[model samples]
Structures are given as structure tokens and as C-alpha cells.
Target: MSRPKPNETSSGFESPRTDEPLFQPSSEVWYKDGNTILIAGDEGFRVYAGMLSEQSSVFADMLEIPLPAPQATHEGCPLVWISDSAVEMRYLLKSMLDPRYILKINQTLDLPALCSILRLSTKYNVVHIRRRAIEALQHYFPTTLSAYYNARERRRLSSGGVSTYFLLANTCREANANVLLPSILYSCSAQQLDTILDGVPDSHQGRVELSHKNKSAVIQSRHQLAHLARTGTLRWLYSGEGCSDKRCVAIRRRVGARLLEGRSIDGFVNPLSTFNDALVELIDGDCCEACQNAVERCVDNGREEVWKKVPSVFGLGSWDVLVKAYGQE
Candidate 1:
């Protein structure tokens, strides 16, 4: 696939002084082959289609050179390098001519951090050349990486959940929860939820939807599931975050306070889309405190603004209103 196209201007890089080397900046460019096009650094990172220019950018960093951000991106985005060598890395960080390139240092140069770039490519909406570059980076990791480098699965059978908490969630949901509850809550097939929920704490009331009750499991899981909610997965199982099930509800309840205020349903997310695609668009478009709170419930951790928005949006209203607004999906 062709690299993603970035808007370009003649002057790509910013100016320089005696201390800085004089390097000419080029606009984003692309070269097309029969059906495919490749974007090179000379043309910025832009391609015929939306492909990321990561390879060229990272390579430029590798060559002790810098690539200016094209006109297409937000100005605040940092201009970072990936050099691991202290001399090279330090010089590269200090050599940054663009003040806009904040974070002056490279975060990852080791195998693990470099490999994470692959995951970042998958997470961010980068495509084409950028995606290809990420795929190539994966080659840096050995086919048989060490235990940590290739720990593909977080919840292993050998180490899945807290024994006590697992028992609790099992017991809580199975007994009181409809055998059909997981399906209703997970947005997954009945069998999937059933299989997962089946690991209940021997004959507890039902799935331990409440957060406090399942503390052991969270500990056992090493917060991996919660991390999935925050970063790994986009499709949150429930109709929304809190309403997904008891565990989700408890997570939010436990967070205890609102981090952001106003109709700003701004919560923490890598892309921020997993939680509030609607919050930023809908709430930002226009939302009352109540609607904001209700929307705030989308966060998995159940932040304070979210709780406040929930009650304000629904709790303040009649039972029907509350049901419609805050009722579990």
C-alpha cells in the first residue's frame, strides 16, 4: 500500500543557527508503482493514499538527521528520535532544531520499546508506509523472543485470576445472574460469556459485577483486563462502559471522583475513541451537566465526573428518566 499523504509546503524544516547543522527540509512526496505507490522521506511521509511516513522518519533519526512534520499534523505533536546510543541519542535530542518537538528524548530504544512501536502502529490509525515500517520493526524482535518480549497472552491458564476473586465472580454471577447475563452484558455470544463467566467462585450468587467483591481477581489478573479496557481493545463488551455489567459498574464506582469537569466527558484513553467518540462529538457539540454525567459513565474506571453526570442526568429525574438515561444496558 502507498504511504498516507501529508500536506506539504516548500519549507519543511524550521530555521537553524551556527550551532545547528543546516539541512534543507522537503515537502511530503510519493512515487506510484503500477497499482502501488511508495512515499519517501524527500516527500515528507505523505503518499498517494494515507500511509504513515514512520520508516523514513525513524530512518532519518537513525541517520543523525531530522524530518520536519508536514503541514498536515497538529503543531503540538512531538518530533522524537529512536536512537539508543547515548552519544547519538543525546546529540539527537539536543540537536532538535524544532522547539515544537517536545519530549526532547526518545522513550524507547531497547528491543521491548522498539517492538512496542508495532503495537502503537496497530493502535493508532496509521496505514500504508507507516504500517509497513511498523511491521518491519517487528523483525527486530527475535522470532523466539524472551519471555517478556513475546508474552502474547496476559491471562494464562497458569496465571489467570485471583483464586478467591475468581471464585467470587463465578459465584456472584452464576447463581443470581441469568445464565444469559454474560451475553446480555458482554456484546459477545452467549457461549463466550458463559465460558468466561463459568469460572465463577463455586456457587456464588452470580457474576461478581461489583468491583469491591472482585478485588482478588483484579489483583490476580494483574490489572490486565482493566488495561485492555483502557488501551488494548476498542469494543467495550457492554452496551456502554458502566452498564456492561457489575464489574464495570464497580470499576467506575471505585474510581471515586471526577478528573475533568463541565460537559467535558474527557476521560483517559489512548485514542480516546474507545470511550468517548460520542462524548467529544455529542457533548462538545452541546451538553448539559446531566447529559455530560450520563455520558461520563462511558469510562471503565467510573471516574467522579462520570458519577456526577450519571446522577445529574438520570438520578435527578423520575424513575423512567433515570432508567432511560442511566439504566444498565
Candidate 2:
């Protein structure tokens, strides 16, 4: 079917008058013989109400509202006004109607497309798109350090680096995805201070900005991470019962020397990875079995302890509160 040219109103009346209002349709592709026209801002889209209603309870409810005298029409279809970003609505509509544009697990969506789907899907209560968006984000920012390391490594191998965690942070809030925030905020905190302000390309939603509270929280996380590097880690490594043994003492000395030489945690965004690296170094050294086991235990304990504090580090509530907010409870 050929695309419908822009008509000024729901009536589809072509007026030769100079006063004919400016009208924009989404694209040639979406202008199907679809029964309903969705007008977002100045851009109109011809699409199926039945398909939208099936996917979204919100749309079903909206469609249930009785239509009065209709002014705008395209190919005998009524034009419905949508108070949303035209770009976002376009993306959402495409994701629903176009098989090729549909979101999938293995396929990567650039930040703009992902953000649009997330924003509109959340607002319109489109569950599938929202789920896919959250899954894609989780792939980028997994909750556990091991998972995060695996995902981060995969991302690095495939696309390089993720510099849009800050943008994801806001989108998570918009989408009621608090579960993703702990990882998102941590990733954002890990970014270089300058880059945090500049933001990554394609993640900008209107303005690429962080809340003042979040900015301070990131700064605090850096400071706390530094403190953990200097004292907390070293203290944990040396304050051991096995230290009485000469072999254990030698192991501690070797690890401590490495730490002092800057196997430091100053640059680590996730404390678990930092601790894991330290454990690996200790294991490589000629440490006694007892000391090695003790160090490993310390790493496990420290990881749990740090994870519990992660939410607070980013100015959020305790873990329990955050998990409940994310509807995990």
C-alpha cells in the first residue's frame, strides 16, 4: 500500500487554502491501511488499534473511551492525539508493528532506541517491550560482580565500553526499574569525573544531566572506595589469626607489598572485583593453605558487606527497601 500523504485534520479534507495547518506523519512505512491514526505532537501515525489494545491495557482502556464528532481522518480512519515525544511514539509503534524492528535478546539496541522503547512502554504499560529493555540493561549492568564482569567483558569484546549508565539511571526511575539502579549507579560512579558531566553519545534525553544528589553520591563513592583501598583491604588482609605462623606472615607480607605498590582499589567501581583481584594475587604467591583460605573467606565476607552498603553509597535506602521498591519482594 502506498503511504498516505499528510492531511490537515481527521476529516482528510484537502484544502487549497493557504491556512491549511502544517501536518507531519511518522513515516512512509507505518502509514498502513491501519484503522486508527495516532498523532504524536505534530506527527501522525496510521496504525491498528486492535494490535495496540492487545499489547497494552492502557491502550485498551483509551480505545474504550467513546469518540464524538471526529475532525481528523486518513483513509476513513480517525486521528487520535498523543501527548508524547514523536520520536518515542514512533519507536514504540515500530517495535510493535515491524517484525524486523522488534526487540530481541541477542540483538543490541543503541541507547536512543532503547530509551525510547523503555520510556513509552513504561508509560503505556506495554509489558513485553519494558521487559526486553530491562533485560538489555541487566546484560550491561548485572547485579553481581562476577556477572557484571562477564557481561562487561562481553560488551567490551563486542562494542567496547558502556558510558551510558547515567542515562540508564534516569530511565530506570522512569520505568520503575529500581532493581537495575544499584548496578547503574555503581557503573556511573565508576566513570571518570569529567566524563560523568560530559555524558556518552546517544544517551542524551533532552539534556544529559545528573541530579545534584547523584553527583555528590558519585563523589562520595570515589572517596569511600579510596578509603577501602588504603585501610579496609590492608587491615582485613593482615588482621588474621593465621598471621602467627611464619608462612602465613610471609604470605601477608607479599600481598601487602603488592597492595602498597598499587594493586589498589582507587579506580575500581565495584569493590568485589577489586577484592577478587587481590585474592588472585594472594593465591599466586607462596601463601600457606590456611592463609589462602582465610583470604578467600575475607573476600566473600567483604563482598557481601560492600553490596549491602551499595544502595546507601549512591544515596539510596538499604538493600531491603530498594529490593521491595523494585517489586522483588
Candidate 3:
């Protein structure tokens, strides 16, 4: 579709005259036959009104309202100004307009696109798009222990390092996808203390910080999980009951000493992941077969126990509650 020049108004109807500059129509989103032009920020998207109304109840009601006097027009289409970032609106519009944009089975959306689409879909009552976005998040931050381990092993979960957890946590709250919070917040608690408290820099939004309530929750959970890591999850290290082999006993003692001295290979914040690769290799490679089996059983049972406590650790109740609440939604 050909866009109008800056100073040129569309053919038939007079434009809303103002000293403020007109929005630049989005090249990617503009449709020649579209009847409505939705302006978000300084960008205008010419899209079919009927299509939008069919997908979003909020848009349906908004478009039905009569525009008084001279209506705003963009490229001869009726214009409506929306209070959302242009980038976010573009993501939402594409997801709604293109059947393959969001629903593709093999597609992996980056964090920003996922959050933006989820937020707008939730706000506009676009159920399918919102559900798809939430499913993507669940793939990364799953509710079950086995599923989480599977995702981690397959390298499907992207933490985006420590900073991204803060962004994801806030987005989950905004979209009301609270079921993803336990794993997301656990990732937040895994970061360094100062990093958690000071927040992290985001490319688009300067710095992102958790809400005060969540900040406290993660910090407290960090301490609690660290304690559990030593006393509960990794207690096998210090339990002094390995196999009869002297070498295996020595390896266990060395690893236990390191953990006691606060020099653990996996760090101490995440109890559920305390048996990381380094520790796993130490137990599996050098230890006697009986000792290896013992450690495996302990690690499995301990990680599951810690995983079950995760939601409660962050004041989110339990897995059953979260599952029920999300189902009701």
C-alpha cells in the first residue's frame, strides 16, 4: 500500500488538523484495503476493522463508538489512537492477523516478542494468542520437576542470564500468568545478591527491577534455598556413608569440605539444581558403583523434595493450586 507523504492528506475526508506531526504508517502492517488505521505511539497501522473486531472484544467495542466532528484519518482510513507502544502493537497485530505468526509448532519467540504479545493479548481478551504465549513461557519455566530437568538437559530453556529473569517475572504478573512464577522467581534467586538488589540493564527499558514484594521474596527465598541445599538436597555429601572404597570416601569428603567452605561448584542459591554437572561427574566418574547409585538416589529424591517446595518458598502456595487457578483462567 502506498503511504501518504507527510504534508499530503488522504483524498476524500479532511484530516484532523493539528500542529502535532502526523504518525508514519507502518510499512509492514499497512493494508491498502484496510478500513481502520490504529495509531500507537508515533506509528500507524492500517488494518481491517472487521478482522480486529472479530479477534478482540475490546477492539470490537472501541471501533463501534462514533467519532465526533472531523475524525482522524490516515491514508483515508478512519484513525483510532491506542495507548500502547508501537512495537507491542505491531507484535500483537501480526500475531492476530497471521495464522502462522504465533501458532507455528517449531517457532521460538524471543523474550520481548513473547512478553509483548502476551500482554496485549491478555488486555484485549485475545484468548488464543494469550494461551500460546503462556505455553511458550511454560516450555521454559515448567511446573513439574521432571519436565524442568528435561528442558534443561535438552537446552530448550533460555534463562537469558540473570537479568532476563527480572523482566520475565514482571511480565508474568502483568499478563496474570502466575503459574510460571515459581520457576521464574527461582531463576531470579539464583543470581548474585547485589545483582538481584540493584537490578539489571535492559536494552529497551533502561533498568528492570522486581516489585518490592517480589524483591523481598526472592532474596528471602535465596537464603532459605541455600540452607536447604546444604542440609537437605546435598546432605549426602556430608552424611559420611559412601561405599567401602577408600577413594570414593576421599572424594566425598573433599567435595563435602568444599561445600561446607562455601566453595560449591554449583553455587548455593538453587537447591533443586545443587547436583549440577560438575558434582555429577565427580560422583559418577570416580566413585564406586554402589556410591554412585547411592548419590543418584539421594539427588533424585532431594531435588524432587525441593521442587515441591518451590511455589510455597515464593509464597505462591502449591503446584495443585497454581494448576487449578490457571485452568480456571
Candidate 4:
């Protein structure tokens, strides 16, 4: 492949940037017989024009434009300059050209790789790749509460916690994956206020901070969620008439007092999740069966209510709006 020197603008094409250093051919995606070279950032990828055109309508239209005689060529093929992140472009091109580059395993993927493919795929109009990337994200951050709980129980969800949520929120916004934002932002609200504001440390990207708008939303939602958890999800412990058993009534008062004091035994932001089996056992062991059943019903109802309000709490309108904006799949 012919290596383009620094600051050389190809004829009949506007270079994406003029100050970029010499373009380095990608060792992974460069093919000896490739018919076209794609320049992203300071990296060059030699790939078959036909393959790209076949998978992406954007590429198809761009490749169809005829160049003047003696057009700029890298090696013996056409040079196409693209304004995209080199790392992301490499991930997108590798996924398209290499059969062995698996995008997912058990519906889970590395966050950076998944985000890269999603961004470039959406930009380049690669429908299948974009769909797969969205599906992988949905596996971890589902729209419905039941799916969220199921993934949580299986431990198959992303383990990056608040950091991961911050990344997902930004990526989904850029990729126009609006449906995934509610769950992602809700997860972000579960973290400490300081952590959210200070940003999460990322090895490759440095400290990843939420946008100013997102930071404000997450902070407001955090306080609102904590309040709701006590007043709503665990309301049975405070306002409900316990069974005639004096002991059951006492247990309710004790737990409710502790919760009001911001002393959650489980330390979970989601009130519904905090009332796990262990907490249930603590209450049920002393209370009558009827009281036990009533507590469960209250928690379930509260969880549903909170789930319904999540999108609005984060300023994303409603689930109906989000689903319509980004079709559920």
C-alpha cells in the first residue's frame, strides 16, 4: 500500500484534516490486494470496495462517485478519506471483514468495543451491525423491570456499574439509541453523588464524565429515587396496619424507622431491590402470613410505579415516546 505523507491532500478529495501526521496502514485490516483505502484520523485501512458497498448504502453511494482522470490513489486503488475515530473505524472494519471477530458472547460484550461498532455502524448505515450492537446493549439494560431483574439474577449484566452507565448514556445518545437511556441513567443514579460528579476513571479514555445535562439529571433523580424508595416501595413498613400481632407491628416500626434514617440494611438505591429475600425473611419470620403477603404486594406495586416513572424522571419523556423514537427489538 502507498503510504500518504503528512499534510498531503489527495486530488479531487478534501482531506478530513490537514495537520494529521503520516497515515499508518492498519496491520489488522489492511489487505494486500484491497482495491480501496479508507483514511480515518491518522490510520489507513485497505479494504475491498465491493464488500463495504455491499454492507453499507453510505459506502455504496460514496464509491459510485467517479473521480477525474489521474485521481489520487493509495497504492493502485482509490483513496477515500473519512472523518471518524480511527479506533472506532478499525473496530467497525474488522467486524465487517474478519469472520473471527465475534461481537458478542452470551449477549455480553466489552463496553468500548460495543460502543465503537455501534457508533461507526450507525454512521455508515450498516443496518445489521447497528441492530446487533443495540441488542447487546439491551441485554444489559432492558426496558422492562422483569427483564432487568432476570438479567441481574443471572449475573449476565455489565459489571462496570456506574462507570458503565455513564459510558452507555453518552454512546446511546450519540448513536440515537434513546430507548436504552432510562435504564442506563437509572443505574447511574444508584451511585454516590460525588462519584457521579467527579467522573469515572477509564484507562483508555481517561476520566469519563457525564455531560452537564446528564449530570444534573442523574443528581436530581438520585435524590428523588431515594425518597421514593422510603415513601413508596417500603411504604408498607411505615403506613400500613400490620396484622393484629403486636410483634409484627413492632417489626414494621423498627424497620421503617431505620429506613427513614437513611440506614438501609442492604444499601441499595432501588427500594424494590433492597427488600430482598433476606429482609423478607427477617420480617416474615415474626409476622403472620397475611402480613407477609401484604408486604410483598406493596413492594411489587411500588417497583412497577417507579419503573413507569423512570423515563420522565430522567427527562426522556415516556416509554411510549422512547419506543417510538427507537423501535423496540
Per-candidate clashes, comma-separated: 31, 7, 0, 0
Candidate 3 per-residue lDDT, tens place, 1-329, comes to 22333333555554554566568879879888889999888889999999999989999999999976467665677888888989999999998887777675126676667778778899999988888888887777899988877776333344454556787787787777889999888878877777888998877788888878779998878767877777666777867655657788788777766555764233554577645653676656577767776777777788888899999989999999998998888
Rank list by lDDT? 3, 4, 2, 1
TM-score (C-alpha, index-matched) for candidate 3: 0.84
**Best candidate, lDDT:** 3
Candidate 3 segments whose C-alpha is farther than 4 A from its true place = 1-21, 153-160, 243-250, 260-268, 274-288
Report how far off residue 104 is in candidate 3 (Å). Answer: 3.5
| RMSD (Å) per prediction | 23.6, 5.8, 4.9, 4.5
Model 4 C-alpha lDDT per residue in residues 1-329, reported as the tens digit of each score: 23345333555444333244447888888999999998887688999999999999999999989965546566787777787878889989987887667444224456667777888889889888888787787777788988877766432344554566687778787787888888888877776667887998877678888878778888878767777776678878776544767787777777666656664333445654647653566465577777777777778888988888889988899988888777744
- What are the clashing pairs of model 3? none
TM-score between model 1 and native: 0.16
How well does candidate 2 match the true structure in TM-score terms? 0.68
lDDT of each: 0.29, 0.66, 0.77, 0.75
Q: What is the lDDT of residue 213 in candidate 4?
A: 76
Top TM-score model: 3
TM-score versus the correct structure, for each prediction: 0.16, 0.68, 0.84, 0.80
Q: Measured by TM-score, how close is model 4 to the native structure? A: 0.80
Worst 10 residues of 1 by lDDT: 182-191
Once fitted onto the true fold, the runs of candidate 1 whose alpha carbons sit more than 4 angstroms away are 1-108, 112-274, 300-329
